[model samples]
Target chain A: MARLTKIKTRKKGGATEILVLVNHPMETGQRKNKKTKKKIPAHYIQKMVFKIDGKEVADANLGPAVSKNPLVGIRVAGVKKGASVKITWSDNKGESGKAQTTV
Target chain B: MNTIRRRTFLKGTVASGFAAVAATSGLLRPTEVMAAAWPKSAFKSKKLDKSIKNLFGSSKVTASKAIKIKAPIQAENGAVVPLTVSTTMSNVEAIGVFVEKNPSPLATSIDLTGATAFYSARIKMGKTSAIHVIVKSGGKLHVAKKTIKVTVGGCGG
Candidate 1:
């Protein structure tokens, strides 16, 4: 799955607002492999990091229980109107994707 | 007296055997049995380090409560669950969702631009696990998490 779509950031009060869309399958290990007639091993994204203007701001540890194509909302303080923000995420399979935006 | 003693011994032997059998069978829950039967190599990944670096850069992330994740305490269907993450902080840059128990864990990541802060979306749940929300604000990381129980697993169960 891909990360970050339709990203938008705006000014709200004294801080900047942000919105985003994420694409992911988020498969749990319980599923079966159709071709092999065996169970597919569990594989899901496990970590995510969010940064604004090169500074670490947020991080998360994930598990298999989350749903697919998950969406998230966040607000940060002291961000400028045109500053850049970067988002990165990784899964158990060692797959990673990145998205960046300017507020 | 000999006959009564013989009967009691037989009864004791039978009870012990039954208890042993019950104990052995109790160890086999359907989920545990299924997991054990599956091969471990099927889920192994070789690119874990590269993936992490590519996504989060080299900086370490801290835990905070600037973000909130809203999900069902118990999901009836694991295939689809409605989830929402919202934060009150300003100058937000990005948000991410994670499942703590999934083999791959990192479910989705999103980046935002301009200054707008609110977002909403639906995601799939395979099993019961914790959901995490991470946000970036003013160059610092803020996070929140919630546990969700998934019933009727979505992974083709």
Candidate 2:
């Protein structure tokens, strides 16, 4: 199966910054097809949660105005090396996707 | 008699609502509840002030110097504008980003837990406009803004 999300991390200001890239169209519903001239229905991730070792670190409520293929970075303090990280996201249409990584 | 009637009406409504959930989960209503939790009006608001009010309950905000916004002064492509917000504030509860020109001004809102008051994300700008980042800390909302010039709008074809 193709990965729907990718995570990368780096240390920043004494905290570990995790960058999550989710594969999504993020259609704004206002966009019109160049040739078809039909409005693209809005379909974007509405919520996402980032957890470390089963403990929640950040919870996001996103809107359709976010760019396609959402790239989000969050900083967590005192993150141990080799900590398991996971991101679960759900879209406006109730479809969900998830990805995991280790720091 | 009036109290009895009102109670009956309430009970009937609750029963139907529960039945709908039962049809899907048999008992638990995770999907329905999550779907209902998304702030509908907040994301539908077109104007900046209205969206700010819907998201944070008030447009009245204070500008803070402690907050830093790392975004380009100009975006060649409006579809993907990289933005990052980092702060030294303590007790940061939430962070939100708004685009003044998008069809829906509110772009993202986040709840932080055990975090270091930092967030980076990409947002679509409908056009050249001011983008605001609001940070909730110590029960007060602090804001920082940057104007990004977009050569092409991201909303339409």
Q: What are the lDDT scores of the predictions, listed in order?
A: 0.58, 0.82
Q: Which candidate is the best by TM-score?
A: 2
For residues B1-157, what per-residue lDDT tens digits would candidate 1 score against the true structure?
9997567566655754653454347564422322222111112222333222233442246676666666789989867777777777887765655555555454555455543454455556557987766666675656677889987766566
Worst 10 residues of 2 chain A by lDDT: A1-10
RMSD of candidate 1 to the truth, in angstroms, is 18.8
Lowest summed lDDT window (length 10), candidate 2 chain B? B26-35
In model 2, the runs with Cα more than 4 Å from the true position are: A1-3, B1-36
DockQ each candidate and list the results. Answer: 0.15, 0.49
Chain A TM-scores of all predicted models: 0.78, 0.92
Query: Clash totals for all models, in order?
Result: 46, 1
Per-model TM against the reference: 0.47, 0.84
